[model samples]
Target chain A: MEKTQIEELVAKYNEGVADPKEIKWIEQLIESGEIDLTQLRELSGLDEQIQKMEVLSPSLNLDDRFYAALANEEKQIKKGTSFSMPSLSFLLPRLAMAAALILSGFGVGYFLQSPAQKSEVSELSQEVNDLKEMMMLSLLEKESATQRLKAVSLTSEMSQASEKVTNALFVALNQDDNVNVRLAALEALKPYVGKSSVRMKLIESIEAQYSPLVQIALAELMVSIHEKKSVNALRQLLENESMPKEVKTKISESIDVLI
Target chain B: MEALSDNALMMKVKEDDLGKMSLLFDRYKRPLYGFFYGLNKEQELSEDLVQNTFLRILKYRHLFHGEGDFRAWMFHIARNVNNDHHRKKRVKATEDLDNWQERIGHHENQSNEMQHNEEHNMLSMAMDRLPEDKREVLLLSKFEEKKYSEIGEVLGCTEGAVKVKVFRALQELKVIYKQLEKSH
Candidate 1:
């Protein structure tokens, strides 16, 4: 048979579409050993070869490696750093460059202490803080809750706090959708509590928080700081009969102490 | 209850429900590993390719359109990962028959088994000798049991092209197998 005829026959045979006469012809061709059955036999033999393939088991920790990569990716996505930071290893070089820039700036400032240059040095130093604040603010505005939480953590590395940082943390605490992130934002704001705005916002957010855990955390923070202004919020929490009994008791104790 | 389909799971992945990736991985990792192994006959490289395939899926999940079979999209990524790996390493698909047998754990202790082992090794090495494109078509069609249409999707070709390629590849594979057998 011609090559096309054989291919047509083989395709039909494999698909089980060959008629009885065609099947008999294929059988006779194979039995006569005139038509090579290498392709057909090889196709059938693959099932056995596949069965015999050494059953390769990858490293036992393959899943662990995959999951670790996944988790690391999740961390990056949450931090809004997925595009910027491909891996933890990439951070080191960028950080070194930042450090070198800072050191060079200080070195330049130290040598150029003339009065006009001194003013320039102070402005440059202020620019660095402004840049840091700008980064924190942008990170805080990211949509990923994990990224927002990372922003909260990144604040701890800041050389100095600013009102903008305080405001961003307050927004995260009062309005973030994710409970853990909101709690993280509250934690970030704890050190800035000396700010009367932070104190007032923390007090005001008590009524806005629906999570009993946040309410309890707020009540504890208010009681610990002895913020006498939280008295009415605690009183309001007490009136809400749906409050978890534990939270109600905590709020009651907070109200008594505040009074 | 019917489990969520692969396309649904992939759609969830695209939507950033990344944890759903674990389910897809559980379903596909073995077959993917086998496909790579069939091409390269190397365990470490095949596993690395599998890992890379999954990583690429995660990195590019947004590109998935959720229209056709999820397996087709995934294998498309897998083929790309394998091609990239092959390019970087300059790994020719061909391996010597003895090396293939040894890697596959052929032994001379049993004469009967040795005969069978030699035939299996010849077939594998013959497969390895096929040009990469033909070998890929053959592996997808014969070993992976993917339909020509699905293979076309994975290979970025039309179904008719895949059918022609499968037929021509099988013919070439048969020639190679005959030569290997004759030499043996």
Candidate 2:
């Protein structure tokens, strides 16, 4: 393709006038891998540095964690809770899924309107709830499996003894309302959190935060202590009347694992 | 295992398989994390976005019924969650000092020589020259390895639109590169 053709397509693209065929042409260039990518970065002036910086900049480990949250999110949906996606495409997929799901849902709803089907549906919902609880437990376990710091500091020393960094992370974790930030802080705190004495407050943060994820992380940390005292602590949290049932169940499950 | 695809792991999670969540987490945590890291210089913000992304997943787990490839679904989630975050913050991500330090330090480690360092430096400099929308399309498609469809999903444009944006982004980059070459 002539360079002008590519540029014209791009102009149309910026103007929202590009045709689909022209789009495909540009994609072919990108897929062919002939173009240098650094030039395409969103933030100008950083590509040269990011490339240079790429070596020291270790890859982020948020993908798995996002998957786990998504798993919990599914459960929340089953329990009649819903969150919207910000992507414009969300409306499209959601509308499509809603159509598909609601149609199937209506068919099933009508067929199941019979007494027996209703009973069966209720039974399925119960099983689903159990599954949700079970998933919650597993998610909690996964969150606890690591000291949050294991995410960044590959070496034990780096993960620990870096008071400056740890404190910075803690401040970020507790103050950052964005769950990802808190989770990252919790992960970053992993190295420092294992201290039997100083880390007891994590359980408090878990409670105060009111986020299931932090609760899971704290519950996981406590479960690994293997000390009878820690189990008692988890049992106390599990049995606390003020604690939400979901959290209580999570605490119980983690305790069960320890016991 | 490779045998347990993303759908399978999601199925397992649905079936009360807690370990499967870890299996899923093990697979994409870094890639997703890298996604945020690419957009923001604040390591702390990247972590926060990752957490919210996961929370969104938990809240939307029912949408993850065993049919679709979970990886794409997960990215769909990440993209949405991060966009929401970017909106709420209302802060345009300018270069951070820490990012600069890390970049220069990394170059020093890779090639203590002047030439390769210049190539890396010029490339970044040229990228910094593009407009945000073009740069964003380029970043999502090139660095994030998002499909045209996925890019559209994230940016709310069509796949065709993403292709055009990418093409223009590259052309723009070429212009910047030429400008950099001439300046020297």
Candidate 3:
């Protein structure tokens, strides 16, 4: 066979569509020294080499990011830009779980608080709540920012917040480096603002916050909650020479409303 | 029982069972990552492209006709997403393949591992120089193991065209790889 014929045969052989006759011809050529088998072998090995290349894994949060994105899209689908209370259908299952946990806690509390045991039922109940709070705090301390956000969001699912949960939120608000996590902590703390301690913390956080967005958000929250005590904090914030004009204005107006 | 196919899972996604997307994601993320990683060799950007691909999949889930191969449709979307990213960062995306070693050199330990795989490294650099279309065709066919029919669907060409492309791409790749090998 000529060189052109050998090249044609090699191409066919590499394409994996060579006939038995063509295969025989290639074998005959290799025997007769018309074509180098090594070259043809290398040509055929390209695909196999590519396949042998290692597959790369994306970061660990790929799934978490996907689910978070999916949930976000689903929420947008179910409720446009409008404000709608979380539907009872959605809340029922979570509510039932919380209720079941509380009932079981009560049962254990009752069993442990008999006459011989001499432990107060309230103390046992408080201990259960404390355990739940400890779990929340531990979750918040996770390395993943998503886990910390999840921990903050879980506070809203609790039947009620303990002092520890509220304190954890305050700590997250003032210290979390990620703006989104801190913002999530703020949103989670919204329902608890009626508490005097929460109100005091929100007022005090005004001075501690470095993020203009969080400071503005805290000021607005304090004003909305009608915490008269925040007037001093707002006034003190107004005294900071480097305060942005926009936030300073917001604080002054909030102070006017409070006074 | 056999698990649900990609098309079936995607059909479920189209019908508002969005949770089924997780199943689809689990099945396809690695392949998608492989495709993007092959294109740019940047892990973070590749991961971002994968995310953008899935997000587009959801955003345009309504457009799925439930007719063709779902994986093909996905790669089609992925190609579009990558093209969009390229257009947005065309100037910055022109980094040469030689920089790959320097980029990965930051880890220090992987330097030894990379030296041990010189052929793989050279092959990758050679692959990086192929025209994007040929490169993608080769990747989808050789790496992802898609059939000519699926590659055609993804590339919007005929199976015959894809077959011709695969042959031509392999020939071109061999020529390029030899040059790179000699230079190395």
Candidate 4:
């Protein structure tokens, strides 16, 4: 196509008139350089010139600044500073642990003094008070992780930095043995779950979380995306009558809400 | 992390290396300024946005995690800074029109040949005519040196879809240029 001919095709495409065949021809010509649409290239260059005139022509290059920024960022890393990870929350109650030791020290003195919370303790333990505490801890941890994840999408500048955090989280999510830990990691990852690369990995882990609780969580997340294609994927599980009832129920509910 | 990456610089900034942070600021200040100047044609505001982008970069340095493509990330930040400034100031529609006359006047005395470069002026005038999203895609792809696929990733579209948008954008340019030619 000549310059004007290519321009005409573009014009038609712009007007929504060019058929697929004409579009293909235009693409092929531009790609192969069969027709010298030098005029069009020059036109493209005009935008480039104005851009250069505005943005690039003014500054020194970016290399030195990047190096300086890196130097500052890495100082602590180079200093061999090691951050101690916080102690895990699943430890036994400290007061009970203390009381057992203190039982030997003197008369059997109870830990003291809140009679009201104490009265309800017997009933609560039978309801598995420890498990409730653990669940509460998990919920707190989930909230904390969620807050951390939110900073990722909060600004465009942090994109590269966020990706790094995502990479680290992915490794933790995949390899961590504790289902609760993995669940926490998944919650931290929920905001970034839409990226195809991340979504695929999340999908792969759904089956491995054989616990019904985890499956329900994953199923709800699975169909939450606005994309219909994701809903269809969950619908596949819904169609499988032999699939676990809990997973199907979760997916079916999500599909209903999403669709 | 690669030595030259923004993540590496962010690490340095975290270490309290003011000198490195300064260099990074200096490095980005111009391109960032140019980015704003391309749109607003106001050097002072461009400089202010450039400085503010660096300040925000520094403020958020501790938040750094290594990621792909730092330059694009920085540009995204700069883009937001410009928008934020626009929001705070609220340039009225007529003010932008006034700007066109003043901005065009900056080069009015140039040779006839330079004036005849309809392609150059047409782009700005055409982009000014476009909806905001269309103009954004063109600027990012053409001026920022971002690949079409990368632009799609940034804009949340497929590369093929971005290609379609670019085609329309250029057609808009041609039509506006033709109209200008007719008016003369």
Give the top-scoring candidate (TM-score): 3
lDDT of 1 by residue, A1-259 (tens): 8878877887787776778788667666554444444446555565345345553456656678788888887787777744553786888899899999999998997886799987887789788878777888888889988878888888777766888788888888889888998888888888888878889999898888888888888988998898999999878878887888988887888888888
Best by DockQ: 3
Question: What ranges in model 3 sit over 4 Å off?
Answer: A1-41, A80-259, B91-120
Q: 1 or 3, which is superior by TM-score?
A: 3
Interface RMSD of 3: 7.7
Candidate 4, B1-184: lDDT as tens digits: 5445565676776666656666566556666665665566554456567766776776676665556445666766777888898786555544566667654565453333233433456545555666666667667775456476666656667666666666556656666767877876
- Across A128-204, the per-residue lDDT of candidate 2 in tens digits comes to 65554344323332344343333323322341234444455555456655566577667656666566544765554
lDDT of 3 by residue, A1-259 (tens): 6778789888888776789788667656654556553456665588678778777788877778888999998887677546768999999999999999999998997776667555565567667767767778999999889989988988876768978888999999989888788888999999987777787788778777777788778878877788888777778878888989988887788788888
The lDDT leader among the candidates is 3
Q: Report per-candidate DockQ.
A: 0.08, 0.09, 0.21, 0.15
Cα lDDT for residue A135, candidate 4: 43
lDDT of 3: 0.80
Native-referenced DockQ of model 2: 0.09
Query: Which lDDT tens digits does candidate 1 get at residues B5-32?
Result: 9999999989888889999988887878
TM-score of 1: 0.46
Ten-residue stretch with the least lDDT total in model 3 chain A: A30-39
